[model samples]
Target: MHGRQLCVCVCAAWFLAANGEDVTCLSEYYMGREGFRSVPLSPLVYTPIAHRPDWYWKKIFQMRGIDPESVKSGYTEAWLAFLFVEAQEAMTVCSIEGGRYWDCILDVRKVYDLAQGSARSTFAGRLAAVFGITLAAPDPLPGHLRLSLCAPARCTESQVVQEIFPLAVDMLMGERPQQMLGNASFRDVVVAHEVAGWHDFDIDFAIVGVNRCGTTSLRKNMELHPDVVIKGDEEETILSYELANRLLPLKAQVEEYNAQVQERITAKFKATGHRPHIVGIGNPLLFQSALVRQKLALMPQLKLVLAVCEPVGRMEKIFMMEKYCHDDLPAAQKRLVAWPYRDGSEVCFPSTSALLTERHGQLKLFWDQRIATAQHLAALAELFPSRLFVLHQTELRDTPSNIFNELAAFVGLRPFPEKIVFRRYNSVGGHRTDLCFNASLVRSLQRLLEREYVMQESILQAFRGIRIAARSTRCDLVDKVDTTYCPNMAC
Candidate 1:
């Protein structure tokens, strides 16, 4: 466990129990002794239940859009099965007496609160209902109130990690509490159909983002091992294609494109099962849209990893990279498309400056979008805190070697066998960093990035409260601005 986590637990126990809240920890097997306090009429009995029968569950799985036969091939099967087992156990003690609404609501709220470490997305009551916990007489807890209660319940994180984590992962991944139950049931069917296997991976990492953040580089460096097969960039693009269909009514051509993307990704993963490849998808665009996050959640054991850099540098790189990624247009055509810019905004230029500026009302829009990303990361982190690692691009420049090692450790992979080397160069010749970046432009961009970072840091700190403190290492070089303007050449 992280040292900060230990301190948080000690602080919480001292505050809540000391303040007369009857927060009982319940099971010694899972919750241990210290984190929970007791209430009168709270039963001490705990009963564990096996997953539901396969015949009834198979249909339930199909309803949730999972094919039992296909689900067994990936990690999703084991995850769903574990969730079913927990749901069964939770349903048993949903209420103190016989499904008493207030009692059961409190019970489910406490468990999920601590387990999720924050207010669940307006689904606390519904989630309770899934475990057969009903609310009566008392009002359903306000979203924020449930959140406050849940935040403190994070004291039970270690217990959740050890025993109930996989189930919780399924629950969070599901569309609703009841939907999660279905997923759990399907998990059982898949596990039984597959094998009597032991030792499924408890932790896994996902490179999550809004695309163009060096997710590809992160995955490649981390997946150098023969055992690691990171998914091709196109596979991750399937989620985007899915989102595009939902956002805009697709023409037949677009629909065909989406089908191709999905088939390509599905086939790629299906082919890699022969070797125990620690599969990762680099769908950096996933962070931009809420729908993509929801779709990804269903595929359990995903650790959302985000790689962030200075807004200016990231925007600049993104602008440069987009030309290559979407490179069908000729140079003259691309120039024509970029020339008619309103407020200097063009598809070719990184338009993200509008999103990253520090103007008050404008800042809030950026804050909302960033906060949404953080929330997505937070939910995944709550499910598997150790699995989620947010890396900053500055770290790569600072301690490239250690960053690689840390990344290797994070993704459950061994680092490169050859001595890893850090190469420092931009698209423009880069023996010197200053030669590439205009001093005035760099200063302006740095200021903008720092402001944006402060806002992002605030949101991240609020959720996980883990601040990464790494000293930035600087390379000395002469400050000479490059004479070249934007490289107008098409990839």
Candidate 2:
């Protein structure tokens, strides 16, 4: 148990007298007790409901435009509607940039005017009509140019417009949140049947871990390949945390996802008459979830990818996200000098002194997250030794095409169809680290690495580019710190 779960699992013990002998009854099992998931510390209760009948689910998929079996050829230039299949009512503001891979950024305005006022150009017409869009139909009205959908129990349009839409837009587009505010270059643009094409394909692999460690840029570059189709949002996924931690025993959602994957194969067979070789996603946070073992148990053939960067550099990225994940960088930068570790920011951004107390636990947890990667890797090793691939961020940044070619070869993916021009979407980390670095804190942080040393070392061996407390790395205070506690520390 990492000891930071927010679920309220209330337990109380009552002493009872049964024929003069004291007997105890307890409400819940404690951590490390039997019947608990060892890693997440959540109760292990995965009783998949018996398959009663799924005759209607296919119809539901067809109705939702997820199963595009009926759409004929020449529908190649079709659009993807951002569907909220579950919600009864929703609102979305969708903006589109055309072509194979489009650049789109959505913003919810109290109302903003279009670029060409009242002009009759087709793009402008579409923009004017969709500016205050409302999605009421469970019936998906997909056409040539749509990319977002949502339905939620919102009290007022004001509530949906002002709060929910922007949050959803930011997440769906950035694959990470609030990053759209700074970079206009982040996108994975499709989430439905029309534009994704009816090519029968199986998910060949999963990029599961080391979040904030170049997984975003990695997923983007890989997606650029003509052979790859990212089924779900790489940044925020329906397949990662939601699939792993379903707090209810109602049903296993993976069954439906598995069914959808299978249907894609069947759909492609009917469409092009040839099955495609690959479809995959990167739900980076899944590497640490209780679902790791559960997923392997279900899809044992699944290949895993972990992006590794120097630990401290990874933490510095973590620090940036914690401080500014919700706010845009320009606006956030304005607030920086005024409120260093401001009041409303995430808890981890506590003042420098707290680095010894509250921040100590936070920093420890961050490294523990890195340590947890070892546990997942060990499990993958036992299951299938050759199934896991480690991609180092340093290598990816320095020589984009070469590292991509190596990963592509490992995963059976074709090479990039064009010249590999890699662009990083998050530039906030390039700022001055003097704003948040403390040498003692970094040294102490490296001390915590001892717990996961052996496991981390094995992974480092697998990927030579993996650096530990190296002065050449991008971490906040590596050069400034007097010493690194990690053994064999080198650039």
Candidate 3:
């Protein structure tokens, strides 16, 4: 699978095993430049986390004290070197080639008989970029090129090698390869993870849905639930993509996700000593991908909370968002990724102001966009009715206390404190509190609300069990008129 399979031959090595057959790395099939031979396997395992660990190594420092944090974080090369000086094994395996250490990040023979696939094609190029050395193309089986990298201040060698090891193993083993070499970060968390019976993420819930809704506030409330661990920002852009990649197989994606998060959540567990049962990402844009409508399908067991408001209000809030709020947006749209729009085709503007100004003409695009999102929501509800929850943004704004407590129970977590304060993380009705919709927009907005809004009891058709917030989706128009905020102008 790694390289070309030449003319078929009856080789005993190719005989079927329970899992799969062993790969035969042939020299003629494998491509290489000039003559490259075997390089002995270097003993260097995980790269030191800190780059300048050599600086700290000294017998003089032994008389003084070593920093425990530095050692724990893999920056104690000085202490380690002092210990290993007599053995000379470490010195034999590694060397100060130039000014910096070119630690052996890859030895092709250990994982495979030959340099193949990504290791064959791009490994040399990547090593050159990172360590600044152009290498001849490596050969097969007998050996090719070995890639060693000199890291900057931080060592990403463990991450880079770990990605390669698993993918390349499948070619040799025929089925799959279990990573023999452990990531230093992964090693730190394995014991704690097993003890806690936790997977990558400990918590059981996620807040996935409409922007400008109370998704932020809901997550914050959950964090206050006595024993909970919520990592990173309100939007988990990294973790969300892994969960929603339509192209990648679930197992492969999960293993990669595990490799990443195996360190993240469990590290928090180690620090806090409280094994939080409530740990999950809260990203509002999870279901926005048209290609992967079933984003929640990635974690089917996960209890999903989607907070949605009346369509007009949500859009209006974004339109009225303070300029200061859009401060982080770039001056010009460099790429489609600048905005987390559904896909590459969607119009991307630099700022919220630009989006509102340019795309205001496509106001009725609201129904198409939201209705499609609602369909995605409906599909998830059908699949995991007991697990999927639709939270009414109107209700959350109305009765924050009750909504929070009930939501905690939904996720099988304890409620927030009885006297705890509930604050809105995102609420922007700055420009005009009154509705400014014309008659046509008003009618369209209501239909959008009734079809999708949990408050109207319309979405309840799919999700029967949820905390309902009784709030009036009605406000007087700014044009000296009274028209309802919700669909069908009812309440």
Candidate 4:
């Protein structure tokens, strides 16, 4: 009786534990892990397609010897049909049993190698990095017999497929073809080609980040110099995350998007009356996202200028200024936010944390997968070398003269103009934050920020170093425009 009672207790405990957790797998943890491995999450989600059926892929072993049913379930119609035809052709060239396997392996390796350096590398690397495991094909099975599906585990087969789906596809696709992968720019394709061969790059520079950094300030200042043509913004992100989701092994969507963006910028300069010598795109958010690094690897000629601010202060600025999150909140709930910067107006809070994890319709899941500051910054720096230029709020206010001069030179521009204009907005520090959150809630946030940034000396140091470097290198001639009121709704 005691034995049965103890067993019951054990079963109950297991049930309770299972019931206590969330359903979806942890994504942010994977993201942080990917950063450490110098890979981003996008690429791992897709892989190249191959020529033959069960030719060289390890996943073929997991499924019984390639049956029609197995092939049908493994890939989409276009990709699978193409593979089937290719397999038939490859078999004719070298029987599946003979030298064909070695040929297949060699071919797949080339494609994999090429993608390893481009955005795809970071994408696939991200998964490998997060799981803290390397992706290696299982050794080929013995000649006659095939691995069978016996009693299966409780997990669904789909879960298992998602895991090895990428590698399986790559084995089917042979070498990296000449055609551009989907819409990937020529610049990015060139980078991938170079990386595949493991060669040095002559890339001019990189913008490196997406949006909201001092990149705007840097770009504006650089624009004044006769030598520079500041490139406008484009959806470079579509190339990284969206295109990575497809089944076409030859198509790299993210690269295509960036290529188009770059071309447009280049064309804009070519069409103009007086084309500038130095050309660049200032999309600050790109630095925060993995896509920028991938794009940078391709356009080696493009120099990089990254403007960084204190993470805690930046987050605060984002939250108080209302960058992107305002769209999600209801107008009634929005009105609750009182902006001290403007009279009787509402401000936006940038963090989506409240929506993703909050008790209301939004803000709940937002905090659930909030990316860490150190992780975000490190990911960008890892992708691009010394091209990044950092700027800080404190540094700008403290040593404006020296910092401005250094910044100008870093971007290969002229000296700073002694007098400059700055657009002034109401100081947030003095604003009454009472309507923002209750004291207890504010305390909780403070603790969160302190835990996230204050303890991270490395990130702080990187920020400081970038700022000092920019100041020491460039010349600043930005005239602070009039008090440019941040649109209340936009903030």
Candidate 5:
């Protein structure tokens, strides 16, 4: 009866010591089973009993029939010995849990104090000298002793390793720290670091431009490539615009923006079964020089694709689209009029006659920046050098296969599918023939924009020379339209 009573008492004490508040630890035990059952010790509850030598002695004798006096006479030395053994066991478990092979001097003295002076300089030093881990004291807590175990540099490459290393070290030092394996806060830190690395590499290119050009069509076709992942809608304008405007600190905004982008790209790659080689954004408003500079500063390796059309045609399309809104779409007209312009002029969609007559100044100001498409592309080419790619809007419309093939090569993609079809998207509709003005007014407007026309011709010649040199042999897929349409019409 006494032996059975003693066995129950030992089991109960061992159970409590092994698991402080965890109910799951008790699930493995069979109530009426014979002999001893193995109950894995919880690292959180198992602190080395250095301060309570008498209790340690009793538990040791009860569990393993080892007399404390026979093992060692000095209490401090025995305690250090016990801690050394526990550290070894903890490190072994950590290694099994994905820690790399560490090779450093184990400095337990940095973590724990001994009455016999530094543990590194004593018998503890001799015992730990043969191991690969170095134990050091972490930042001291006010009411607790904190220890950190560091392995070789290569061991911490994994996010799991980064999280588990600290917890395992604390456990080895008998700190009884909380488990952080699946904790959200800990996981966020790991993810943030991973996202930072991801951002450094993923945004390989951008299609920044003049708004009315064929950016939408180019982006849509680019998305069809297996190795490309361009956002389906318009580019993420707020990212570049707000950052360039300095509404917030640059670093913080960049991190926040890239984190959102990274999530999307990750999900896309997971579903597509092929990792995207180049992720791009197509935001026409990013053509603003200030925004372009800001983007370059953020990603110096960014490849730029500038798509430009005849300035007058683009401006006319923009004006006609506005007119359609004002005359036919009342709700859209209300919204359009309320939209803010950088020049502080009231937004208006005047009749074509009024636009060519009274409101010409506002129209000129609105299209002036865009009309100088050659200057913008030249400036960007000078700034970005080989990283810049200029695409003619006409080619995008007439010979899309050739343009897309060239674009695919420029942005580092395998040649797109041979049977690829490029369809015009987001083309402006509802343009009225009555929007055309008198031929005298058209000549006057052409003379006003003559410099832009010359620059546009120069850019077309430059791109043509480049294409011819590259030996791009694809046949033009669509018939060429009269180039004189824009110059002849009062667009």
Candidate 6:
């Protein structure tokens, strides 16, 4: 019989015996129809037209109570059809093959294994084994017999076939194409798999700054906006650290860091019709050059937000928090004594008189160096002139709405909806003043502020000079103007 006639005879016999219903085979039915050509299995190049035969074969298999996905060769439409017809004949239609189709099926499967360069144990193989039939070793077909019904060329060399039924192929083969065998490199595959099933996005903005200076609150308020997606509650410290250290390849590191974040932001985008204009993460320690350089390299257009506060208040809050956590005064004093200073100077726990008189200037310098103020912000501004946004911690606390509006404009986001309410989050509740430090320590910190006046003024003067120069150029003054000196100090 001709190829189409043989296929129809086999399919009709299998269907009648298996399902007790007479259905015309797809190839035979469409043989003479216009624009309908049977997909040739001998050459085995999977094309879009091959789906028609695969769909018909799936229906037949489903009618016979077999899951197409459970079959090993189900990925290739032609091979799956051959397996289905052969397995049906061997198991159910004994009259057609005279109780010998089991051997025939094995012969075909061996050819398939040889062509594909791998052996796949199938449901059909298990069934044949139950019938006490042992499959012969895979043998190379003779040249004259190579184009037989069990031809090797019918199953190999076409990834398009594997892609057609990916889930079944992945399940059977125990690997995904995108994760293991795609044309893309291993790194590309890994990155693609990490961000799979989500919309792609980039980190557009970041709030990088002082830890106790309302960064958490700012992040919370920003998330309330329709166009913003902030990934975590506080700092993504490890990611920032990795960026700073170059601990891994840049692309791999970024993908690892942002994979979960992208999923979260994508979920937000799906829930609301609004796609995020700004997706961000915050880490207070990102002010370091290494971290900043990596961030700018990845996204040169990234907008940066920093929060500033009165240096003494910031230091006091930190100290009070530490004191409250560790009640052992002597241990706390020891830790302070051992604390590494940027300038490589050590602070000894001082007596009240010593702090009040002689050691005062030394303590003041230590506190000043620890405070990231005008000098640090100015350096950041120089590097990111158009991108840096500075918010005073006091203003953010007092006038949140206005500050948020300005922040929105700076990051190129739409104004927050009037109905959206902003709530203070991660606030250090209650008074830090009630947490008493040693009287001498308080005096020492106060004096430290007093002594840093000249240096602070010089830094502020430098910032003002930049601001004045910026006014003449393209720089927009979005940062909060902080000209007023601290009331406790002489300006």
Rate residue 421 of model 2 by lDDT: 74
Check candidate 6 and list the clashing pairs. none
Per-residue CA lDDT of candidate 5, range 1-491, in tens?
A: 25764464356447655766332222222221121111112111123345433544465445556556654533233343343334344444434443322212223332333212342233333323323223233222112322223232233334223333333343232222122222323322322111111124347778888677877777778887888887545576644545332211223445766676667677778997877757788887666554344335345567878787655555566665543224435444333421223233345555555456644475666555645565666555555656777776768766888989888998888898998677776553333323443445445556666676665555556654533111111111112323222211122
Model 2: lDDT equals 0.43
1-491: candidate 3 lDDT, tens digit per residue: 23222222223224423237322222211221011111222222223435323332332234346654556554233434433231122222222221112222234334342335654444444433433334565432223233322212122334323322233223333322333222232222111100000132333677777666777777766676655666564476644454332212223444554454556557666976656656667777765543233334435457878777665656545443321123233421121112333333444333333333444464446435655655666554555657777777766766888878777778777777787777665443322322343444445555545645543355553464444432233333233444223211112
Candidates ranked by lDDT: 5, 6, 3, 2, 1, 4
**RMSD, one per candidate, in order:** 19.8, 25.2, 19.9, 21.6, 20.9, 21.2
lDDT of 3: 0.44
How accurate locally is residue 275 in candidate 6, as Cα lDDT from 0 to 100?
75
> If the candidates were sorted by their TM-score against the true structure, best first, what order would they fall in?
5, 3, 2, 6, 4, 1
How many residue pairs collide in each prediction? 9, 5, 4, 72, 0, 0
Q: Give the Å error, residue 274, model 5.
A: 2.3
What overall lDDT goes with each candidate model? 0.40, 0.43, 0.44, 0.38, 0.48, 0.45
Model 4 quality (TM-score): 0.43
lDDT per residue for candidate 2 within 326-395, as digits (tens), equals 3344455453422234555455343433434644465667545656666665654454556778766667
Clashes of 4: 72
Q: lDDT tens string, model 1, 1-491?
A: 34654564455556657777434432221232222111121211111213333543454455457666655432342433444333323323332222211111123333334333233443454544443444442245322211001112322433233222222333433422333332233222111000000112121456776344455556655554444556553435544564332211113333454354455445655875535346666767666544344344444565667776545445444333332222334552344322222222223322333333443553455344544544544444445444456666656555767777766666666664566554432222222122123445555545645555564465446544646432211111223433322232211
- Poorest lDDT segment (10 consecutive residues) of candidate 2: 88-97
Per-candidate TM vs. native? 0.39, 0.46, 0.47, 0.43, 0.49, 0.44
Tens digit per residue, CA lDDT, model 4, 119-215: 3444344434433445443222111111111111221333212211222222222222222133432222221210110012222344554233444
Regions of candidate 2 where Cα sits further than 4 Å from its true position? 1-201, 236-242, 245-276, 323-330, 333-353, 359-374, 435-437, 450-454, 463-472, 475-491
Query: Of the candidates shown, which would achieve the greatest lDDT relative to the real structure?
Result: 5
